[model samples]
Target: MYNDLSNEELFGPSDYSETSDSESNNEVSPCSFNEPINNISYTTFPSISGLILYENLLSHKQQNELINGIVEANYFDNPESNQAMCFGTLPSFLLNAIEIISRVPGLFPDEIQNREPLFDQACSIINLYKPGEGIASHVDLPRFEDGIVVISLLSSCVMQFKPLSVIEQGDDNNDNASYYNKFKDIQNTDEPIPIILRPGSVLALSGSSRYNWTHGIEENEIDEAGDEKIIRNIRVSVTLRKMKQDQLLLNKDDSNSFSLEVKKREH
Candidate 1:
């Protein structure tokens, strides 16, 4: 739960309005490219359903504040190793970030928006990555429900997404080997769709994009953004998720079959 903060504190007073004048008969607004809220623009990838990139979601000052907060927490004691911290509850330091996101109209599902606290569980994973360090392609744990939000800070990186190929576990009792091969084949393919995540950008994933695709960054010192090459830097990513009521454990059988659908670059 959060205290009542004025719209001026969340967004510039002149940029946002808290009045009901914009709402006609209490109709909810849909998050689309045509209708941008709070001077924030977004790009949606056709290749992956429910994948949205909210560009410049936070100001430079806000980004710095988050980075400083993470540093002060002493979560990154070893500068040489990649580390991650998981939170079952929302930390006081992250309230500002969550508040800023909740202020954006129509970015989340209606039911979620209607909730008083927005997210009930408010589980989060904060990852600190050094240059040339990257994570493997994998899906989030099944314990989390849909509507996963990721906010990137400090430096920009390229994240690639590829649809998973279904492999029936029938007769193949070795699930580990099956999953390893599937991920290896999917990631080794040349048809992955890459998206550049700039500083203070928010990436939302749900539906097919959330469940059917594998997203990860490559281990490279340099990443390509269109024609320009960006040198990788120390970066921090905050991934927010809501835990399911059942708190189900990871299910290897939940992998769904998906076909390739590569859409043109829209970012």
Candidate 2:
């Protein structure tokens, strides 16, 4: 029903580090992206944050290309977890993204120079929504967590966040179990904060959205003017972040060793 965005690099590939088996330190966590929802400010439901992207990330042509089935060879792969590293082949974009993300306040200074230059190669992720397959509105867990840089590719879609109430958000006591639970009836809630996104748009939302609120893509339809009539468009976004494993790989990223917070799941 929508268009996919694709782009060739304005900037070229980057100088990333190579690691042997035991070199876990330089390896950034490949967010397997499972457990798609979690605890947070909006208990009954996740609060709302609008869509965000950098104007310079992608050129117009690169941003509005036709999206078809992505070739499997293009992404990072983990056979065991059925995940691919979407960012692996595109070190140039990933590196540029790191420079952008480091400017955010929460991203520590040391973390940027050491880890960002090496730890994170790129992000690898894919989102598929059927006629009925859609996400309920919810906040992302662990606010202000990673040094995040996200790029959007594929079909355009609507993502929304519902308004939160005083009674809705509970105290954040830094507890794991509490945050793990999903409270609000996220499946089609109300008071939404909404935005539509296009391909080639890059969003640096981790500094804010990951913790403060909940957001989701609404079930939608598509209409094409080209050869195709209507097809449920797929969206593939690559999110780059400075996580615990990234810091560990580059010892200079932090004064202390990497803490085991929000570790990457198997991929």
Candidate 3:
């Protein structure tokens, strides 16, 4: 199921370069990276509310370091079509990355900071997608809190988002079909919006985007972004989320059962 696309075919020839660091850089705090760059472009899709994209949020060096850390981390073959690594507790090496992401201006709700107890249980997942591999469309379970941050590394690809109402119509149960039938006319007209996630970039989905829409990447070696055909690479995504404590308790007997349920759904 793997595509044998050469590095040259995917990214052309690599141009390696190195630069000296300036003394001014040493004075800048690591958290400063979270501040928005004036030149960086961002967009929020009209179709998918609360979906935000920040281009080139991380530096090339930071991206390389994070990728290396993930590679060295324990990862297992995910039944959902890619390799997966889950972290219940943030590791020391990834603390810097987490700090940078946490400090991202205007990304999280103000109440998020006050919910430190729940945030302390914050977990992360690293999904490694090789060429021709991608996730199917689905919304995250409600066991996760409202805010979801995903940092893209190593490559660029298009992620598509569609409304939940449309997806429910496809369910096998008659109750779901009946509930969705009223919107069948409108559902047929709804189209998935494609968002191109670049390497070292960040995408945050909250509010309506987190609860009402389904997002996934299409399985392909190359993705169409406007006129450019962006070739896929070993795309790694770091997803950070806080656990919904109430939902966690209500959903299963305990944390272990909840974990098992998650694994079962993936398979």
Ranking by TM-score: 1, 3, 2
- Tell me which of candidates 1 and 3 scores higher on TM-score: 1
Candidates ranked by lDDT: 1, 3, 2
lDDT for each residue of candidate 1 in 1-267, tens digit (9 for 90 to 100): 012423332222222211111121222232332234544566667668877777666765676677777777666665543445343444555767777776776566677556666543335567766778777776665556677788987777788887765641112233434444445444345477877777777888878787788788888889985565767776788877766756524322253332121221111
Q: For each candidate, C-alpha RMSD in Å?
A: 11.9, 14.5, 8.4
TM per candidate: 0.70, 0.47, 0.69
Worst 10 residues of 2 by lDDT: 36-45
**Which ten residues in a row are the worst by lDDT in model 3?**
16-25
lDDT of 2 at 245: 52
Clashing pairs in 1: none
Candidate 2 deviant stretches above 4 angstroms: 1-51, 60-124, 128-132, 143-147, 164-190, 206-208, 222-232, 244-267
Candidate with maximal lDDT? 1
- Tens-digit lDDT string for candidate 3 (1-267): 224644333222222111111011112122234465334345556666777676556665566567667556534344443544343445554666777666566665667634564232335666777777787666665557788888887777888777877455344332423433433344434677777777766888888888777787888999986666778877778887777777545534424311211231131
Best by TM-score: 1
Q: Enumerate clash totals for all models, in the order shown.
A: 0, 17, 0
